[model samples]
Target: MEIAQNYLDSIRFEFERYKTMGDATFAQLDDSDILWRYNDLDNSISQIVKHLSGNMLSRWTNFLTEDGEKPWRHRDTEFEDPFTTKAAMIAAWEKGWQCLFEALSLVNPDNFDTVIKIRNEDHTLVAAFNRQLAHYAGHVGQIVLMGKMIKGEKWVSLSIPKGQSEAFNTKKFNK
Candidate 1:
């Protein structure tokens, strides 16, 4: 039981960390920046966020009970930008995260072994969490990369700054 709880706690912490990274990147972006794309082949931050939120909502809504890929979800449409304002986009993002967290709250050690379904495929709860965590992290990486590109030299470092790793390590070791 302790082990199961610990695992869930670790997963939650990782999800929160990734979400924070995305939030920080969003803060550095302007409304226009969120919609900027390199080319027709590329996706803008808004589209990525839309797709992420859509996936979150689908996968986490009735997480333990229903298929992660909901029948009502139109995945292709997620790539089409629907938000005209940054606030709206962020709201949707928050909604999706909220759904995920709420679903996660329902999971306890007793049910840790419950099977989850995604597109008719069976997944243990841990496997499902791992899968989504990887997916979300990948998208957040894209967001952070786009934010850096859009901000150029003005981009704030989310981790140790480019040449400051030495200083960061020094401070860490001295503590």
Candidate 2:
């Protein structure tokens, strides 16, 4: 149980970090900037948020009992322009992460070896957790990168500022 609890805690921490990064990024942009896509073929931040939300809800809900891909999930539709406002997009993003954290909290070490199905394939609980973590992290990186591109020089660094690396490293080394 301790293992499961720890795993859940780590997942929560990771999700929270990503959420914070996303919030900071969004705060740097206006509605128009948030909605801007690379071109006609790329997705905007709004679209990515929608997709992440959909994935989180479907995969986290009944995670152990059902497939990661829910029957009601329209995966392709998530890419379309549905979010009309920044508030809506933020709400959807928070909702998805909330679902994921809640579901993860319910897991225990006892279930670590439990087999879960995703897309008809069975995976151990740990494997499933790792898979989702990788998936979410990939998207979070994209979100941060896009946010930086949209904000340009106005973008605030989430981790470290330029020319401050030596200071940051010194602090870390001292610690």
Show where candidate 1 strays beyond 4 Å: none
lDDT of all the models against the reference?
0.94, 0.85
Candidate 2, residue 127: Cα displacement in angstroms equals 1.3
Compared with the true structure, what per-residue lDDT tens digits does model 1 show for residues 47-144? 99999999999999988889999999999999885676899999999999999999999999999999989999999999999999999999999999
Q: What's every prediction's RMSD, in angstroms?
A: 0.9, 1.9
Evaluated at residue 54, the lDDT of candidate 1 is 96
TM-score of 1: 0.97
| Residue pairs in clash, model 2 | none
Q: Which sections of candidate 2 miss by over 4 Å?
A: 1-5, 171-175
> Residue 125 of candidate 2: its Cα lDDT?
75
Clashes of 1: 0
